[model samples]
Target: MKNNRYLLLVLLMAVIFFSGCERILDTEGISRITSFPTFQMQGEEIVTVVKGGTFTDPGVTTVEGYPVTSSITGSAYIVPGKTQPTDVVYTSGAVDTNVPGIYIITYSSTNPDGFSGTTTRTVFVLDQQPDPAVDLSGSYASGTSPGATITKVADGVFYSSNAWGGGSTVVIPAYLICTDGVNVNVPQQESTVRIFGHGTVAANGTLNLLMSRPTFGPPPLIDLVKDWVKAN
Candidate 1:
């Protein structure tokens, strides 16, 4: 009977002392904690990380924030909580920060009581490529149907009437200004400019045409005058 009572006291004391035993209380191997690592974020590509057998405590992850959907490169990371973090520190990796110009990265951590400390990593973001350039300042000319081709006429030869429905105007070097692939421009209101050879020649023979209002000039001229009449 006395031994039973004595055993009860010892067992009671044992319950109190063993209740605080750390190894018995610790279910996970703390030594197995993973160290947080850094990553390079690209513009907006998929980014990922692997844990070296460490379990993710549901409400805990890396300090970069939430588990990022691998499709969008963002400021996401597997942040270790107040507990020590573990995972091989990464180098030579890339991810997309998704910003237009440039960006940076740093490291930090959270505590068990919801507080945080920090370590750091860095990342760089770059710009996308630009479109190609084109040049179209040269010369081109279209005739009648707006699709008509004006043949280069020889000296003393006559050019036929085009969709303009009148006799052709001999294009002289002086009267010619510019010709886009579609339309043509000439010196403003030149009545009879000579079709000197392709270069600057003097006194080349010319073709004549009836000029209309705004003072009759040659045909094939783009008349830019707009005379607006207001009623009194």
Candidate 2:
């Protein structure tokens, strides 16, 4: 029984430690565990550029491994006690501001131990500016989720307080863009989670959002809808 318990404990530790690692450990021992590298975008996840406008990348910062205790710093496999920021190389989707569409830019970095992390940014090229007369800024709540606050950033661009509905414990925000006053869309972006959605605003100020979140997992939701009622 004790041997089985020990084996189970070891398995659990391995699962937790190597959860996001891209490569197998170099050695059999646990002395050299590699923490996954992460990339942080320097600017907003979503940006809009007018037709024939020039778009400049805001760039990103990459870090290898989480900070560990001083005792573990001596391990050659582990990054020292401090976080190591590295220059990351990125691959991006083409962006032509002259065309009205969306573009995606992805940034990726690999740690010394071979673990890699990736993040992405989205850009929208508009033929014309959003209509300012239509504002959907307010608190919206659904039946399954709590509530999300929508704040207007640009004329028709909005930022939600929470990405996956309102009741999610992780408060990742999603951007909603409305070219017209009625139709709304959530661009494809990563807020620690990847999300793509679209919906509309009703005459009575109700928001009906259909979110497609592969990160949330499961049978691949296609028709899932969240009817958000605007609360003053």
Candidate 3:
């Protein structure tokens, strides 16, 4: 009977030891569950904007599935393909509005628990539209002497001559700014020198130009106004 009692005591001790070990493992698993938080994005993953335009942010949110409650903060940044990104704001400005290309926007969030998450979105900045009111693809005459000739070399680009007088020829790059197609303004720049001019086109095919050259002093060194009419 004593031998049987000793055998039963050994079995009971083995069961008790295993039960304590299981309890310890269960507590450790629960501790790990409450230690980390969760995060994710909530809106559009892709968007597009025109060149020289503004961008709108969709936004993001965090999800904490565990019993713990923590506040999460996020930030968005830009990664350009070729040129450096500029004018970066909080959630927008992932793409450079002045340059046309594909860009990536990374959104990252972090909590007090040292846990973090990241998501990404793609942005495409398209080329700007051409203005119909300002057409610089023909010949023009200002006063007398030698007339100016303008030819359309490419989209939104023009090659011209007689910009600085003396019958000298130069390439003139122009950009058209139109408000409601009726009011048009053409800003032109000389490629060789730092001479710039802006002109307003009237309904009678007359272009009134105000030209200027920047100087190291307070005011510009050269400022002249001239009128040009379209030549047949």
Winning candidate number (TM-score): 2
The per-residue C-alpha lDDT of model 2 at residue 54 equals: 92
Candidate 1 local distance difference test against the native: 0.27
Q: Write model 1 residue lDDT over 58-109, tens digit each, in one string.
A: 1223544523222111222212221111121222223433432111233335
Over 4 Å off in model 2, which ranges? 1-47, 51-93, 98-123, 166-172
Q: Pairing residues by index, what is the TM-score of model 2?
A: 0.53
Better of 2 and 3 by lDDT: 2
Write model 3 residue lDDT over 119-180, tens digit each, in one string.
66655454556443445667777765367676643334344565533222433333333322
Pairs with steric clashes in candidate 3:
none
lDDT of 2 at 129: 76
User: What does the lDDT read for residue 16 in candidate 3?
Assistant: 100
Q: Judged by lDDT, which candidate is best? A: 2
TM-score of each: 0.17, 0.53, 0.36
Tens digit per residue, CA lDDT, model 2, 87-195: 1111244566665445666666677676666676767765467887988898877665757898987766787876566344455577777767888766555566656
Rank candidates by TM-score, best first.
Answer: 2, 3, 1
